[model samples]
Target: MFPIRDHNPSGRVPYVTYTLLAVNIAVFLFYWFSLPSDFALAKFYYTWGVVPAWLMQGEGYSGLITHMFLHGGWMHLAGNMLFLWIFGDNLEDQMGHVGYLLFYLACGVLAALLQVAGDPSFDGPLIGASGAIAGVLGGYLVLFPRAKVDVLFIFVIFFRVFSISAWIVLGIWFAVQSFNGYAATDDGVAYLAHIGGFIAGAVLVLPVLMRRGGAGFWARNQGKPPHPAAEYPVTPSRIPRVPRR
Candidate 1:
């Protein structure tokens, strides 16, 4: 299942979120088109992507920030951007543009640090905005746990859309990351970074949550979006429901 969108709407335009989306896409396109070969692309990634070994060696210091802007492939970019588009606006609205931007970068840097701590001897290039975007998801859960998100569920030929609470979605996501991190298989994914970013986001956003009234904030909104949620018309599926014989 993948989250296609959310019913929650931001109170104001999220300029920083949009800019981040544009910048990530732009950077991906620039290197994708400009780099003539796979080797050159790999070289570029090494220069910008976070390499735990290098970072631990006191090198590639810039990768902590730069790596968040890089993606390994089209799907990588699309998935991260989709999450950002869905959850980022609400955060940007709550934190304000400048605050949200700083939070995002801080989460990304912290995520990388956690990944480096996880495997300081590994030399592979860790590239993607997911570490940061995971933070957005983390913050969204704390701020709007009951907000409805429309997730598209696909199972072989069967397809359906389900509107579920944000906490369930983000909670499951964090659980999976935690499981994978502990599994410790060489799957080429930075599960530790995801965990770190998510924790960082939840902890960092606590101050804002407190300012709003801590648990009282949840009492006031009942964990739903602070504003009226956007309504989506339920579309009937083309597949006919068969009656049991």
Candidate 2:
């Protein structure tokens, strides 16, 4: 199941989240524009993407931040932005613009460090905003465990949309990251960074929530939403209608 949207609404505009999305897309265009060929693009990735071995060897240290804006393909960028768009606004509302901006960059930094720790000897360039976006998901889960997230489920020859709580959706996503991190070696995705950034987000955002007073924050705002939830049209089930007399 993939999350389509969330019930929680932002109290204020999420400028940082918008800026992040714009920057990632712009950087991707720049990468494509700079290249004369696909090989040139690949070479650029080798230089800028997070190569853990080179990082550990004290080279390409800047990539830890730069690589967050560099996705490997269309689907990679789409998936990361989807998560960011769904979960980011609420966190941005909670943290405010400046605070949320710092939080995002810090998460990316911690995420890359986690990837390095997981495999310092690997030479592949780890790229994508997924780690940072995963951090946003983690923060959203802790702050709004009961928030409703609309998910679109696709099965062979069938598709449906439904809603579930943040705990179930983000929780399952976290579990899968851990599972894949352990299960696959050559997948080339940094599941470890995703998992690690998630953990960091949960830990780092706790104090902000606590300072606002944990239970009191929820109490004042209600567990449902601080603003109006996004409305969606409920579709009827696809079971064939029985002929009636």
Which has the greatest lDDT? 1
Window of ten residues with lowest summed lDDT in model 2: 220-229
Could you tell me the TM-score of candidate 1? 0.95
Lowest-sum lDDT 10-residue window in model 1: 220-229
Q: Rate the local accuracy (lDDT) of all candidates.
A: 0.92, 0.86
lDDT of 1 by residue, 19-91 (tens): 9999999999999999999999999999999998998889999999999999988998999999999999989
Whole-structure CA lDDT of model 2:
0.86
Candidate 2's TM-score reads 0.92
Q: Residue by residue across 152-212, what tens digits does model 2's lDDT show?
A: 9999979978899889999999999999998965676789999988988888799878987
Give each model a TM-score.
Answer: 0.95, 0.92
